[model samples]
Target: MKKQSLVKGAFVLTLAAFITKVLVFSNSIVLSRVLGPEGIGLKKMVMPFMGLMMTLTTIGLPVAISRLVAEADAQGNRGKVKKILVISLVITGSLSIFVVSLSIFSGKYLSSFFLTDPRSYNSFMAMIPIIPIGAVSGVLKGYFRGRQTMNPIAFAQVFEQIVRVCLTYILVQRLVPLGIEYAAAGAVLCSVLGEACSLIFFIVMFKISHHRKMKISRPSWSQAFRGKNVLIELLQTGLPTTGNGFVISITRAVQPIVITKSLALAGVSSALITKQYGMLTGFVMPLLFLPGFINQSLGATLVPAISEANAQNNLRLIKRRLNQAIRVALIVGVPSTLLLYLYAHELMTAVYHAPTAAPLLKLIAPFFLLNYLQSPLQSVLVGMGQAKTAMFNNILARCTNVALIYPLASNPLLGINGVILAISVGVILETILHYSSVVKSIGYALDIPNIIKILVAGIAMGYIGRALFINLNNLTSQGGATLILLTGIVFSIFIYMLLLFFLKVINGSDIVRIPFVGKMLGKIFPK
Candidate 1:
């Protein structure tokens, strides 16, 4: 695919991701009100196990399939693409079943031992079916990604979030009368239904797309057996990637347990500790991740785009893509970090009505811009066949987090703050490592001056916005506070764009690359 097409695909996926995040944010707001901190805490606790299970079952097959299929598609080998998809499905499907069975059988043991609170057992059980359904969906999404057509994957994402939020609200409402535990479990069960819906959408879309391609004769049984090399290639690419994900997943699974236990040891009550955990995970962290949808979409597209370029030894294209990816990351991350830092209190109060999360949001806001950049950098590494490098870096960072969190969280003075510090440090460290790895892989240094200009622009825009907000607050009544904030934010965006233009951070060429409005902007700007 052309570079313009890649950018367009990323744009489409980003828009979808934005909508999805909004739905998810809305879902979290409803859940926060309905479930309270403890119920939300129980629900959050079950997520790590679910993540680990899905990671284990998929075994990085989606990424491997995407990379391999991109290479095949680049070479115009339809048969190879078909073969890769079939083998991936078989491997992932079988592993998913095994994982689900294990999850069902071991739920009691896991919940009893690993979780600090045993009340999460039912939630753990409810999350088991998400594994197989997600596993199937992962491969199908990978197939579409390799094809460089993002609409299906994008639609599935938004559709899944819609279903999840609706189902979770309905289920939690009905189950709340029984108990918060059952309510939390019911909330967790929504993932199973959501994934099932996404899987169906992916299957239908894949069939529709597949039927449009020219027919290729099916390979005979012996020919299929001869394609064992494809399976071997998948394993070779997948194992290291899976190992990286597995390490991260294991650390994540242990994180809540460690933090909660450490806080308990520091003389905090169990109920208070759970509430703190919920506040951090459910409220503050989601706010931190609000800007990540752009990075997520770009990272997803980057894998195939870079893989295809690498396959054809197109060094110039690879470098251009990497540079553009980094620039886009900064453009999004800098403004987001600044806005969150400046408006943490107001945003928390406005969105979740939880004042307690404001300080935590401010504390973590600085490092999260770097966190947003991590996914895209790691995706570049994977695209370059350097998955192990990214994996090792993540493992090192996660190990650091685990090592420091216990001591810090157990400290009487630091307590929960220690956990937050550990997370912030981990995010910063991981991004630095990933960035260094990408630099080494590409043999090109990032444009430091351009990054500095972007940051400066963002800082200036944030300051101006903050000033406007304060002035507006003094003039407006309580009823108009949200409106004032919104106006200030909109003005800040306009100022930021003008700064980008005036500072030469973005030029006519960049503006002209935007999908539909590019031409109009070019005509008006007349570079």
Candidate 2:
């Protein structure tokens, strides 16, 4: 029953995250298609700043809420969990108001300066309303995650994405024909409406869940609203995590600023620069990073298990679990990055209808490996109660990213490639810092042999896939590209897995445990 429950939780969360990622990808595609690269570029410009605001407002409180609630669950302390929830709502909600105000009042100046085009002002305005709604929704979702009740968050995500896609389709089609300004407004409004819908869905879900619990044992409002305890717990969990999240948000947000400047100095026109940035950061990077969803789900499931082991001072089990986390991260991340690079053009053309994005996609695909692997590593740190280390490592990386970006991007010689290089540089540095901490805390190198194996396997497979793709493109008509690309992908997976199997890099058992692959492997490679 326990194993089943864990698997169930992981499965649901995976589905939820997968859907959320798809929705987000859809949102980006629609925004880009409707407003073009210029509009999407404007949105990207504001994203980092908005992310900073949202991070500060929430201040890691939602994640802290989850941790606190989980801790309370371990102790069978419902009163403590209730108190944390109430406090989380109050703190997150209040911060949301302040952020919303800042966004609204500062929208005009921000839109003009961040984006080369001033026409994105209306879209900026639409984003202001999203702050408060988004923050509240975040807290609620975290609350559910902590309680090990993922359905509420999952359902809310699906509902939110549906709302977002529907609104974007309706609004963009109606508004973009009016002018770029109206298109921008429509884009922002889609976000605001989507967040609002998610918030409402969460509220309903929370109420239903709470009502069911109420029938069992009434929760006292006064007790649940205890300020002092909630504040202490919230601070204990949220503050450090907030710092960690801040680092990540800031690092991602600044990519555009760096890229745009780099392009401008390279003699690229402002009008064309957005497309360049979109090619790498906006499109390719997301697909590469998709496997992180698996890592995240695994990390989430591992947290409670690790927490239990921690309470018992079970060092061996913790080490075993940590190794498992790293292995799982590699298993997902390595193949995904390679596959992305192999089919970079096909994937980009299929999704964005833009073939020019191919080179940038290849350049940025490596970061997918770095990005996804870090999630599990970070989780291991948090589980071990070293959230401060994780926070500092993230801060250091973001600072390095910022520092590297400006100088590299300002160089007239490098252009948009400078920005891409800067991002990759920062990522490599960050990975080093993170791994150092993992080693210091756990007293072992971060499975370097496994990483090497994965990399080699990926490279060999990528080469084969690319060769096949090139041949196909030469032999077949343009419309046959999709069929050829799919064939190459299948071939890549086959070769990679066969090599890994022979090398014993990953065994049949590991393959048998992954969702669809496991069942298929059973049929193909009978025990």
Candidate 3:
């Protein structure tokens, strides 16, 4: 594809991604308010199961389909595309039914094993029927992504979030008055509804696209379906990344079990545990992840591009694209990290109305940056066929996390903070290990000098932000903490960009690469 086509495609997809993220973010705020800590905590308790189900149902299928389609197109074997899609459909559909059945029969036991409160059992049971919808949707979405037809995929994302949020808000608001457990279950019910809507949307788009393509050259369904090549191709590309997805899901599942058991050992009340978990992971971490929507949007675009280049043995293009992705990640990651560090408390107080969440946000801010870097970087590595190294690093990190969390939280001095600290340490270790592997494999450093320059700029911005907010807090009594924080955030962003431009930290070429920065940079710099 031409550079123009690539840019246009990425832009449309990114817009869809950003919009969907905004919708999800808005729902996060709404859910937090309606559910509070207990309701949120209940949801968090069940997250691991949901994550695991998602991984099993969709993880390998999407990766396999997208790669097979892209690879087939590159090799001029158009017949393989349809074959891969059909095989993916059959495989994923079968897995979805099996997984849903397993969940239905075993959800109560799974709930008891993970969640101490048996009341969450029904919620787990409720999530079963929705699994198949999500499973099939994942395959269709990947097929579209492979074709580089991203608009439909993007719209489906937005549609899913809208449906989920609207339904959950009504259910939770009405049912919370009845009880928190019911309210919590209502939230899980939203997932079922969202998945159904998304599946329908994907089917519609896939048919339309497939219909147009079929008119030009039709291959017999039997001919497309009979080839053994489809199975081999999907397994070859998809299996390695499947481990990465499973590890992530499993690690997330372990978190609640670890934290809850540890807190119990410390004699903390169950009620308090729920609140603390909600405050830390729910309200705080999500805020820290707000910037990730941007990184992920870019990452989705980079995957196919990187995969295609690598398939054709285009090393120079791979490096160029990798560097470009890293640069973009740094530009957003550095400033976003500093901004969170500087104003975490103020931001939390403004949004969640929970002053206690401020400190938790501070503890979790570094991980946000680490994740923002690691997520896309890891995807790039996998695209480059380095999934084995990525898998090893993640496993090592999770193991280290499990070992350290227990001992650290057991210490009387650290208490609850120890758990948060453990997560940060584990994340730092994971990032280092992943970076080391990438550096060794690629034989290049991560541009340390450029990284330092960006970090310095970000720190300078943070300092200015702290000073402005400190003063603003002293002066404001009307709009309260939220307004003061908002003012500081706006001022800090403006000042940061002005400094970056003046210092030539972001040059002409870099300016043109960003989504909207080009037009603004043109006005300010006057090309």
The top-ranked prediction according to lDDT is 1
lDDT (10s digit) by residue, model 1, range 253-361: 7999999999998999999998899989999988787777788888889998888998888988888887788888889889888888888888888888888888888
Model 3: lDDT to the true structure: 0.74
Tens digit of per-residue lDDT, candidate 3, span 1-527: 12223344566666777888788789999999999988888877877778778787765768667656655666767777767777776666667778988988887787777688777886787777777787778777777766666677778888999999999888889988878888888898897888899889877776676444642233344544586677766766567668877776677778788888887777777898899888988888777777776677666666666667777777777667776667667778888888877777666777788878888777778675777667666766666656667778888988788778787776767757888888888888988887787677666456666677777777888899789888877787676766677788888888777777666667655555445556676655622
Instruction: List lDDT for all candidates, in order.
Output: 0.84, 0.72, 0.74
Off by over 4 Å in 2: 1-11, 24-53, 100-129, 168-190, 207-211, 214-230, 245-292, 295-305, 340-368, 405-421, 444-460, 463-479, 497-527
Worst 10 residues of 1 by lDDT: 214-223
Question: Candidate 3: worst 10 consecutive residues by lDDT?
Answer: 1-10
Candidate 2 overall lDDT versus native: 0.72
Tell me each candidate's TM-score: 0.83, 0.76, 0.80
Query: Against the true structure, whose TM-score is highest?
Result: 1
List the pairs of residues colliding in candidate 1.
none
Candidate 3: pairs in clash: none
Runs in model 1 lying further than 4 Å from the true structure: 1-4, 25-49, 100-131, 162-194, 210-225, 257-279, 352-359, 406-417, 477-479, 507-527
Error of 1 at 431 (Å): 2.1
